[model samples]
Target chain A: MTARSLDWESGQGERKWRRRSLWALLLLVPLALAGQAYDSVKTLLGGEDLFPRQVAWGQSAHFGGSDWKLTDLRGAFGMSSLPPDSVPVLADFSVKVGDPDLQKLWLGCKVMLIDAEGRRWSPTSAVSLKAPGDVHTCVSAIFSGARRGDTLNLRETFLVPRQATKTIRPAVGLASERPHFLFFQLEKD
Target chain B: MMRKMANVILLLLATALCYGLQVSKPHYAELIGPIPAYGKLGDAVVGRGFEARAAKVAFSRNLKVDRYGQTKVFTTGGIWAVVTVEFAASAQSTTVAVASWRGPTGLAYDQTERLSFADGLLPVAIDPGLPKKARLIFEVRPDEVSNATLLISEKLMSALDSQAEISLGPVAAGADGLPAETVDTLDLTQPI
Candidate 1:
């Protein structure tokens, strides 16, 4: 009888130990999944521009190692070369270089026109507007070799709907500062 | 004793079932391969991002390209297979960047990089409501010309994305076993 009683106690202990192990394994499953998905989650977040650092027109904001200010957002509605019902909107920017490595910092630079509805239009070359001699495009300005404290004029032409010009804002994104870009508020809006 | 024997048999059967499942499962690459949108040569094979229609196919031994008033001749040891394709974006502005020529024996020949300087080639950008024509050139063996397939996609690593596979029907072989309609030289300077 004593042996049987001891066997019952040991069986109960063994069952409790198995139950505890199962609960520990259940907890580890989620931890292992999170560990494996850490890099992917980081990459997904880093690749997307989710945060916008807002800067009002004529106000400078420090981004991508430079101070960027939107100087002008003009739309040419009656351009004969552009498609019907579309206008060529030029976004002009004045950037003060704080770092000499513009080429590396501004690599994969993109300037876009975004409307209130979140409709984004990239820069287009379909419009044949001869920019001013001193004005360089966002991509071309990278190779200009501007020194620190030098001011550079940059422009980007986008073909957008004429209706979108009223609410559109110019935004700048650089490769280094992706996921967090400069979104300038238009004075007209 | 009978219950022990039955349990052993059931366990053996379960193990065999698990082994069968492991052996017959699809490979990881096959599971993540490009989703194919098949069509005939003339039919428009529409993918998720773009639509492609192969208009014509030409075979030539030499290709003449003009760049800035300078003419450069490209000669191939095999044959130059030029496919004229029209592409249009479905929703947004996208670039159709990759094309390949799959032979009858499942060998894939990528669009020739020799014609990289030529305008209106692969990696051409298309906007919505506007269609663009481009050329996909490949140098392939003579036997691989018949029953060929043309594959087009946005980029090279298009896993789980749509890929257009247009079938080119059988071709007639010449007396010399080359494609019968092959031209001696193709002048790419002329507009398609």
Candidate 2:
């Protein structure tokens, strides 16, 4: 009687294994397709909302700052033999919301100017991602122009997000998607 | 027993379906254009002199010369390469000369102009041959040779692979060797 019970248990275990294998195989195809569909949809509709806020930017004395600040205007460039005052300046960027799933929003811009005498100057800093909810960016640069003159130096920075941070109500079992606009301009101001 | 088995299968299938769908967003480069002509530059300017002038960045993977403003290479009506710089004065006299860039191209298509502490900005328009707005070396000329400060910017090649630096001449007294006149220079090239 004990031997018969052992044989019965072995058969039951094998049957369980077979059933589990069948289930796994049957669901794999559908699961894979679902994932692909989700990614495609998110690509079409913004997946998230991200806001640019003031964050601490660790900068050196070469840059205009004490130790830390909420600006990130380190324009990327080669400095192998950069003569002094060789800060390559990039202007403001027009950042619009693309598509994505996000939780917050971040935006900023770099502004620059050149006065009359050819004396380079980087004044009027912009607010950073940390502008007390509204963002206050500051732009600074290490200056050394002719003893004194007229021209002022200028450069600006701008950042955008892959997705909009603002949320929308769901509809037709569809995801909510929208585009945002950021006005980038330069004037006497 | 059969009914229980079917129910278990459906539950597993449902779980799989729910876990399958998710999305991501795309980011685009800022299309900020028309970088206007600034009256002054970033900070105190380096005095005028052809610090260095070698050859154009001969080759690269994806070289870029930014034209902070200005439309296309030659679209801005009478656009030109604008340069600015600051330099030390010699109680003694001196003369500064800029170097010239030599490339496969013929007569380097660039021009030069100098402004003073009282002149404010020295704007010199480039010919239609030059790019509207970009920065870099122009025709074998050292960055600058002037009686004051100078900045030279140029734009070359639209190809991805193109980069290098130009070694310029020294900042010394002219033939006279008198304290010498302060000079500055700048380059205007294509947005390529």
Top TM-score model: 1
By summed lDDT, which 10 consecutive residues of candidate 2 chain B come out lowest?
B124-133
Per-prediction DockQ scores? 0.16, 0.01
Error of 1 at A116 (Å): 7.2
Prediction 1 global C-alpha lDDT: 0.88
**Tens digit of lDDT per residue, candidate 2, span A38-89?**
8687664543222212222232111111122212233324433322333333
Q: Please identify model 2 stretches exceeding 4 Å from their true place.
A: A25-44, A47-189, B1-133, B136-184, B187-192
Residue B10 accuracy (lDDT) in model 2: 96
**lDDT (10s digit) by residue, model 2, range B141-187:** 22223222222322222122111222222334345432133222122
- Chain B TM-score in each of the candidates: 0.97, 0.19
lDDT of each: 0.88, 0.27
TM-score of each candidate structure, all chains considered together: 0.75, 0.19
